[model samples]
Target: MIREALRKLMEQAPLTREEARQVMTSIMEGQATPAQIGALLVALRMKGEAPEEVAGFAAAMREKATPVSCPEPERTVDIVGTGGDGKHTINISTLAALVVAGAGVPVAKHGNRSVSSKCGSADVLQALGVNLDLDARQLSRCLEAVGMAFLFAPKLHPAMKHAIGPRRELGVRTVFNILGPITNPAGVRRQLIGVFSRDLARLLARVLQQLGATHILLVHSDDGLDEISLAAPTYVVELKEGDIREYRIDARAFGLSPQPDGITGGDAETNAAIARRILEGEAHPAREVV
Candidate 1:
């Protein structure tokens, strides 16, 4: 099955939704060999992932994920980003999740450790003494208690274990990068997702719309940052009530100036301290970005 899929992909023929689903299911179920998995990932990337292909992969991932009950899922939102932006900016989305939760909104933050960046949400969270191994029930409780929960990807989507080695060995962005932000274990319908490529903004929005997302914002900065940029206009694809719209946003609109130099990140501990300063109401441009 994978060999045939690879051949089709090499021909630049997009997979039908069902075919992608089957391939991803097999991958998750440990049926595809590491070589096959690598080939599949590279093939899809080279072919330019179609919306149907991304939707299918996300559907299969959701089917295999360990579920966590979100408190009022319709009201809950997840803030995350595809991490291979290569900018290594401070964990903006992670900090945004905490800030949104603090503002009395229910949040289910889905994340993993650093895959392509120096520090991912889980890495920074772990640096801040937050436990990442919580089970589904415990995650639900955490959400109910503080209006926010961190859905660690490895813990919630154990099926991804099969592809971890190949994914690491390949060391390039693949379909899994797109899949992560869309496959929230808590099943929240509203989300704010940052994509590493502007081309992916509308593509991801369409994929989420096809996957039954109620409301979502897919963002990418013109300057190549995944998160909205202070340096340049950020492209936005907003999907709300089944309608998708595209727009660009600039920092000046919010009385903030472009301080691109302020956006920087180091190790987990470094980012953790930056997050703490923002949370503590320190006066910094990063605070404005967050």
Candidate 2:
């Protein structure tokens, strides 16, 4: 059955929502071999995933993920970016998550270790003394105590381990890449998601809309930075109250200068330092990017 589905996907036919869900279920249940999983992922990437397929896959992941609850789900927000942007920026979204939390917004930040960059959200957070191995209860405590919690993707979605080896071996972006941002374990209704591509930005907005997301900002920069870019105009698709609006935002609109030269942190330690400087108002570029 899986082979026939893969053949159809390879033939450029999109999967029905049910077929996509079944495929992901098989992969997560360890029923699909590594070779079969790799082939299916590559085929889907090549053929381009439909929004239905992406939504179905995300539904399966959310079903399998360990849910973390907060006292106020509606008041909580998540800030995350699809990590394969290859920009190696100074972990802007993670910093933004911190700032948002500091301003008293409950934040359930979801992320993993580095995929295409020297530092990911988990990596930098760990460097800054965050314990990433908290259980669901501990995570809830963190949120209640500090107005923020980091839902490490691997910890929340243990079923993903079945595909990790295959995903690393394949070493390319798949539907799973986009799925991560949409599948917040805390099930946050409000989010700011940065995608590596403009197409992904539009597609994710639609997926979030279908998933009943209340307020979401899907952003992609013209220069390829995932988060709202200071270097270039950012294309934004906002999903609010079931209506989707597409627009572009420039840094100058916010009274900030365009920073075409990107910021870089060579490692997690450096990224942590950069984040601290931004928080302390010592780094202008890093502060502006956030």
Candidate 3:
């Protein structure tokens, strides 16, 4: 069945949602070989992922993800970005999650270690003394205690263990990259997702819409940064109540001035320091972008 799916993909034929779900199910169930999985991912990337394919994959992932409960799921939001921007900017989404939490919004930030950047959300969070090994119950407790919790992707989506080898070998974008943000373990209906590519911003919004997301903001900077950029205009696609809207936003609209310098790349510790400083009200234009 996996081989047949791969053949269809190689022939430039899109898979039905069920077929994509079955393929992902097999991969998660350890029924597919590493070689087959690698071939399937590469073929899909080359052909470009369809909305159905991404939505199907996300469905299967949600089925296997460890469930984290929220007392008020409707009010909770997840802030995540599909990495692989290769810009290695400071963890803007991570910092934004903290700010959102501080502003009285509950945050269920889903993240993983670095894939294409020097420091990922999980890395910087770990640096700040966040325990990434918490169980589902503990995660819920954290949310109740602090109005925020970080759901480490690897811990939440253990089924992804099967694809780690293939993803590492491919070393490029795949459907899984986008699926991460959409498959929040807490099943939060609200989200703010950042995409590495402009096209993906709309594509991801569509996928989230299909998944019955209540409210979502998909952002991609014109300069190619995944998060809303201070350096250039950012393209935004908002999904709300089954309606989709697209728009472009400039920094000045938010009372922010465009900074000429881009975010610098660094290891987890370095990025964590920057996040700490920003949260402490110390002024820095780069931190203001958060």
Candidate 4:
């Protein structure tokens, strides 16, 4: 199956939805060898993944993840970024999740440890002593009680371990980075996704629309950060009520000055301190970015 798929991919032919789903299922079930997995990922990346392919891959991942019972899935939103921008900036999506939760919205933030960044959402959360090993039931409860839960990727998608070795050996961004933000364990329909590239912002919005997403906002900043940028205008692709629209927003609209240097981040400990200060109401540009 992988060989046939690889042949088509090598020919620059996109996989059908069913073909992509079957291929991803085989990988998750450990039927595909490491060499096949690496080849498939690279081929797909080289050809540029289509919406159908991403949706199919996300469907398989959702089917395999440990399911969490969200109280109101349509109202619940997951804020995540397809990392690997390599900007090493502060964790803005995670902070946005907290702010959204504070506004009384159910937020299930899905993320992993640092990958091509100085500090990831999971890394900063762990540094603050937040437990990353919660089961599905506990995660559900946390969402119900506090309106927020961090769905750690490895804990929710154990089958992903099969692909980790290949992904690490490759040492580059693959389809998994795109898959992570779309595969929320709780099955939330609403999302605010930050993509590393502008093309991905529109691509993912279309993918989520195909996946029957209720509402989603896909953002990419001109300054090369995945999250919305304070230094430059941010391109946005918003999917709502089944209509997808493209637009750009500036920080000045929100009465913010472009302080690009103010948003730089460091190691987990350093990001933790920045998070603490922002949460404590410190007047910093990172807070404005969030």
Candidate 5:
């Protein structure tokens, strides 16, 4: 069945949600060989997953994820993004998580270290003194105390550890990049996700629906940055009350000035410093980057 599924995907034929779910299950359960995994992921990349396929992949990820519970008034939202921006912008979503949590909505932000860029979300947060080594219970407690939680990606999805070599070997963007956002361990009902590409926003919103997310904002910054960008038109795929809405968000609507400047850093240290000044709410490019 796995071989046939791989063959089908290789042929660029879209899988039904069930078929894709089984493939994801097989992959996550160690049921597929390295060669088979390579074939499956490559086939997926070549064909590109449809919304249904994305939905199935998200379902299997959520099913296998180690669950973490949020406290009372379960209206929690995850501010996470797939961070291979290669643009080295400061941690926008992480900063947004802070403000969103401050605004009374419970937040659980999933993040990882710098892979493609100078400083990823976790890098900047760690620089700011957020203990990245918290256990699951500690993670929950942190959320209850501050209305926010940050689940380090590898810690929450240990299964992905085995795929690190495979993903790194592939080197460029693969199916795994998108999975990071869809597998938030917090089990929140709503989220704000930023995809690296505009085309991915719509596809991810559909997958979010299949994964049981009730309310979500899938976003792409028009200037190729993820998250909401002030300088460029923001592309969005919003899920509300079971309906999918796609539109552009200009900063003028929020009464904020728009400025998307070139964000280029030599390394993580440089980027982390930028994030520090921004989180301090000081005047800098990092503020706009957020």
Candidate 6:
């Protein structure tokens, strides 16, 4: 653990394969002090988390997190965003989960209320009256009943609770922000991930690869959305059957010819209202994209 802190403080990247596993194992064992932990976290962020570091630490999280048992792994899809969009959009990814479910795909989305944006996937979903605090059993039932279930971040990973206050106090985008999307408790093999930056989309792809993700569509919008923007082109990095591909998706593909400026929100209440429109079938562009 001390070595990780030293390496990070030196402005070097992150841990090697064995080192990451060991450090994370130590953390899970409650061996590291709070002071050591905070130092390591801040240093890693400053150095810009490396691919192996993200992969290794996330792998540790996956190991400790409560696993959800699914009868059919092949049919499950997770739709998530890294959520630094700053657009304050009305939970576009959460909205898309409904549309994706409506498309005959089984969705088990993991989300939280907005920390980086005005409304998060969980916030907008909660506004629509879908329960976000369900346990694994209730959540699984919701997925079976509605073809979608919302997995709240706090409910899934209890171990991270201690760091929550520290992360908030740091007042910057911590590694925990990116960790949410990567740590889908449902363990869905397929993922549709939206990131804020084009470069980070590609970088996240590599981490997902290490995490043993099967089929993934990683996207970034030119206009700073964590979703496929109808107003501009969306860059995509995809991994299918162990093959990685990068491409561009035009707004026209979503049937938005005039290019909508993308969904914007003022607060939870405002976004929730938009979500109501989606559920009631107002048939808007957000609806089409979702």
Q: Evaluate residue 24 in candidate 2 and report its C-alpha lDDT on the 0 to 100 scale.
A: 87
Per-residue lDDT over 52-160 for candidate 3, one digit per residue giving the tens place of the 0 to 100 score = 8888888889998999999778899988899877787889889999999999999999889987788889999899999999999999998999999999989989988
Cα lDDT, all candidates: 0.91, 0.88, 0.89, 0.91, 0.79, 0.77
Regions of candidate 5 where Cα sits further than 4 Å from its true position: 262-266
What TM-score should be assigned to candidate 3? 0.97
Off by over 4 Å in 2: none
TM-score of each: 0.97, 0.96, 0.97, 0.97, 0.92, 0.92
**C-alpha positional error of residue 20 in candidate 3 after TM-score superposition, expressed in Å:** 0.8
Q: Any residue pairs clashing in model 1, and if so which? A: none
Stretches of candidate 4 exceeding 4 Å from the true structure: none
State the weakest 10-residue window (summed lDDT) of model 1: 251-260
Instruction: Provide the lDDT at 13 for model 4.
Output: 100
lDDT tens digits, residue span 212-287, model 4: 9988999888888888887889999999989999999998788877878888899999999999999989887788
| lDDT for position 19 in model 2 | 85
Listed per candidate, the RMSD to the true structure in angstroms reads 1.1, 1.3, 1.2, 1.1, 2.0, 2.0
Give one digit per residue, the lDDT tens place, for model 6 in 1-290: 66655565566755775566667666666677666667777887778877787888788777777666554568999989998877766677877788889888889888887888877777777776777778888888777777888888888777766576556667888667787888888899799999988878887888888878899999998877788877778899998887889999898775666335436666778888877887788866566566
- Looking at model 5, the pairs that clash are 231-260
Task: Give the Cα error of residue 11 in candidate 1, in Å.
Answer: 2.1
Model 3 stretches astray by more than 4 angstroms: none
30: Cα error in model 5, Å? 2.0
RMSD of 1: 1.1
